[model samples]
Target: MGPNMLILASAAVLLLCGAANAARILALVPVASRSHHIWNSALTVGLAKKGHQIWALSPDNLEDNIYPNLTQMVIKGTYEKLREDFTMESFVEDSPFTFLKTMWAFGINVCRYESSTQAVKDLLKMPRDFFDLIITEVVFGECMFMFLHHFGGGTRIPVVGITAFGMGPWTDVLTGARTLPSVFAFPILPYVSKMSFTERLQNTLLTGYHWNNMIREYYPEQQKIAEEAYGEPLPPLIDLASNISVILVNNHYVLNGPQAQLPGIIDVGAMQCSPAQRLPKDISSFLNEAKIGAIYFSLGSNLMSELLPKDKLEVIVATFASLGPGIRVLWKFDPKVPIGHLPSNVLLKKWLPQEDVLGHPKTLAFVSHAGLLSTQEAIYHGVPIVAVPFFADQHTNARRLVELGVAVHVDFLTLTKESFKEKILNVTINPRYAENMRKMSNLLRDQPETPLDRAIFWVEFALRQGNDGMKALRSAGFDLAWYQYFLIDVLAAVLIAIVSPLLLIYVTMKTVMNKLRGNSKSKKKKL
Candidate 1:
C-alpha cells in the first residue's frame, strides 16, 4: 500500500482492535424521573453504540433497540408509587434548602424501594466478577456501591458518577478538583462570582453549611441504607465514593459558570445534545403557521404541565391568548385536561421534540421551566428564553440565564398573567435577549468535538487507564478535612509564628520604658 493507503489501513486496524476489546459496562441508574433518565441515557446509550455490552438497571421501562448491545432491565413498581405521591405542592417553594430537602427525601425514598425490591436483590445475587466497568449517579443512592464490592469478587471496578446538574462541591469531592467559590457562580446558592464582600462571605458560609449537612445527615443516611441492603459491613460510603473514575456533568459555562476542574472531571455539558430528527407533520405544521416566530414551551420531562392547578392553567392560557395573532405558541400540555378555548396561534401537545423545535429558524424564543437540558438546548439554538422556574436547579439555571442577559425569568409560585405577558413581550420583542443567546450559542456549539464524542472518549479513557485500580485518579482530598485540605490551620500557625517575635519585642520595650521612668523619678527625689 502507498503512504496514504498505509495510514488509512493502520487506522482501520486500530478501530477493529478497539471494538474487539469492548468491555461489559454495568450502568446502575435507579431513579424514576424521566429528566434524570434522559441525561444518563446519553452516556449509557452512547457507550452501547460504540459496540460495548451494556446492562442498564433503571426503574422505568424505556425500550429502545437502536443499540442492540444495550439492555435495559426495568425494576417495575419499585419507586413509581413514591413518585405518584409526589406533587407540585412538594416542589412549589423557591428555596434551595427546600429543594435540597426534597432531593434528600426523594433519595431516601429511592433507597427504601431498592433495599426491599426484588430486582435489586437479584442484581446483588449475581456472580462477583461479572462486569468490567460500573457507572452510576453520585447523588443519594450510595447503597448501590455494594455492587462494587460484590461484583469482581472483592476486586475494584471503575465507577463513573454522572448527574444532569453541573459539577458542584459534591462531585468535586470525588475528584481532586477545587475551584475558588468566589470565582465561580454557584447557581444553587443564588450567588455569582462577581459579588460584594458581604455577599461572598454569605456565600462561603452557606456553602460550608451545605457541605456540613451533606456529611452529617445525607452521608450517614446513605451509609445506613447500604449496610442494611448489603446485609453486611459495607465499606465506608466516602471510600466507595472516592473510587469514582470519572464524573460526567451536563454543564457548560455558557449556561452555568466556568469553574475550575481536574483531569478526572469531564465537561461534556451537552452530551447527547443535538437537534432532533424532522418533527412529526403535525408539530411542523404548527410552527409553519406562525407569520411571526413561535415560542416553544415545555416544563421538561420532570414536571407535567397538567399537574398545575386549574386556576394557574387558566392564567397561562389567558397569557397565551393575549399574544397577537402574529405570534405562535407551542405549549407542552397534558392531554388529560380540557384547555377550554385555544387561540388560533396556540397549539398544545403532550410531547415535543424539544431540541428540534428550538433549532427551527422560526423559533423566536423558548418558554421553559428552566431545565438544564432545556437551557442547554436554547443556548445551542441561539434562542432567548422566558423561564417559569419551579424548583431544584431550575431556579438556579433561570437566575444564571437572566444574569447571562439571555433570558427573562418569573417565579412560578408568584406568577401573574400580567407579569407573564410582560416577560414574553420583553424577550420576544426586544433584540437584546436574542443577541445574547446567539452569542452564547456560538460558544456552546464551538466545541472541538461533539459532546457525545468527548463523553465517549473520556469514558473509554477511564476504562483503559483506570483498569489497573484507576491509579491516575486523584484521591488526595478523600481523607482531608476542609481545614486541612485548604491549609487554614497551617496558615493560622504561620501567622502566629511571624507575629510572636514582634509581640515579644513590644513587651520587652514596654518593661524597659517603665523601669527607666521609675529610675528618673527616684533621681529627681534625691536631688
Candidate 2:
C-alpha cells in the first residue's frame, strides 16, 4: 500500500479502537418532582441516544415500557412522603411561616432518607466498577455528593452536577464558581412567589443556622459513613465538590437574573424533552380559526386545577369575555369550566399540548402560573406573558420576566376582570414586550449547537477526560469560602482596628496638650 493510504488506514483503526474502548456511562440522580424528573429523563435519553449508558436513580418510578435501556434505582420515598407523615398541613396553611417550615422539613427529610435508604449502601458496595463518568442532580438531595466522596477514593472521575432549575448559589459551589452561601435558609413565603427584603435577610440567617446545626449534628454520622466506604479520612465539607467536573443548569442565560461565574458551569435549558410533539387536532383547528391570535393558560404540574376558587375563575372568564371575539383563549381548566353563555373565542381543555401550542404562529400571549419550565417555554417560543403567579418560585420567575420586559405580573389575590383585561391589552399592544422576548429568544437560540447536543458532548468530554478533568475541577475549588472570595469582613475588621484607635489616641493627646497650655498661660498671667 502507498504510504499516505497506510497512514490513513492506521488513523481510522485507532479512532475505531478508541470508540470501542470508550464506555461513557452517566448516573441520573434526581430529586422527586415531575419537573425535575422530566429534565433528567431528557438528559438520559439524549446521552443514551449518543451511545452512552445511563443509570437513573430517582424517587419517582419510570415505566419500564418507556425506558427499557435505562437502569432504574428508586429511592422509594421522598420529602413529600415525609411531609405527609409529619402532617405538614399547618405549615402549608399558614403562608410565609409554612414556607419556612416546609423548607426546614425538606432539608431534614433529605438527611433522614439518606440515612434510611439501602440504595446508597448497595450502590457503594459495587466492586470499584467501570463507569466513565457521573452526573447527578444537586438540588433534590446531597446524596450524590456523599456517594462520590465515599466511592471516588480520590480516583479521578469526572462528576457533573445538574440542576433542574437555575444555577442558584448552591449549584455555583459545585462548579467551583463562587463559594456556597453560608446561610442555608428556607423560603419565607410558601404561597407567595417572591420574598421581601426582610424575608430575604431572614432566610439568609436561617441558612447559616441550618448549616451550623448540620455541621454539629449531621456531619459526624456522614463522616463515619464516608470513612467506612472509602477507607480514608473524608475531605472537609467545602472540599467535597473538588471532584465535580462540570455543572449544567436548566436555565437560559437570557432568563437568569444574575449570571454566576463558574469555570465549568454551562446553561443547558429545557433539555428534558424533545420538542417534537404536534399540537392536538382540536387545539390546532381553534388556533387556525383565530386569524388574529390566541392565548394559552396553564398552572403547571403540581397545583390542582380545583384549588382555584370560583370567584377567581369568574374573574378569568370575565377578562376573556372583555377581550371580545377576535382573540382565542385556550384555558387548561380541570373538571372543565361550566359553559354558561361564555365567549365563542374561549376553548377549555383538561390538558393541552403546551410546547406545541406555544410553538404555534397564532399564539400571541401566554397567561401562565409562572412555573420555571413554562416560563422558559414561552421565552423559547418568543411569546410575551401575562404572569399570574400562584405559589413557589413562580413569583420570582414572573418578576424576572417582568424585569426582562417580556412579561407583566398580576397578583392572583387582587386579580379583577378589569385589571386582567388591562394587563393583557398592555402586553399585547406594547410591541416592546414582544421585541424584547424576540431578542432573548435569539440569544437562547444563537449558541453554536443545540442545548441537548452541548449537554451530551460535555458528558462524553467528562468521560474521555477522566482524572485530568477531576484535577482541573479540584484546582477550581481553591476559592470555596466567602471570606476568601469577598474579603469584605476581613477588610472591615482591619480598617476598624487601625483607624479607630489611632483617631482616639490623637484626640486624647490634643486634649492633654491644650489643658497644659491653658494652665501655663494662667500661671504666667498671675506672676
Q: Which number leads on lDDT?
A: 1
TM-score versus the correct structure, for each prediction: 0.91, 0.77
RMSD values, in order shown: 5.3, 7.4
Error of 1 at 289 (Å): 1.4
lDDT of 2 by residue, 331-365 (tens): 88764646455678888787776888988888889
For model 1, the superposed segments whose C-alpha errors exceed 4 Å read 1-19, 88-90, 152-155, 517-527
Model 1 lDDT per residue over 1-527, tens place: 79767655654454455588788888888866776777788888777656688888788655544554677777778545665656744486646666667777778777777767787888887777778888877775666767766774124567777776777777866665655567654456655668778777766766676677777888788888888888888777777777786788877877776676776777888775787668889888888878887988888887878778778888988998899888899989876678788788888888877888888888998999887888888888889999987776677788788988999888776878999999999999999999999899899989899988888887787777665646566657656777887899999999999999999999999999999999999999999
> Could you tell me the lDDT of residue 224 within candidate 1?
83
Model 2 weakest 10-residue run by lDDT: 184-193
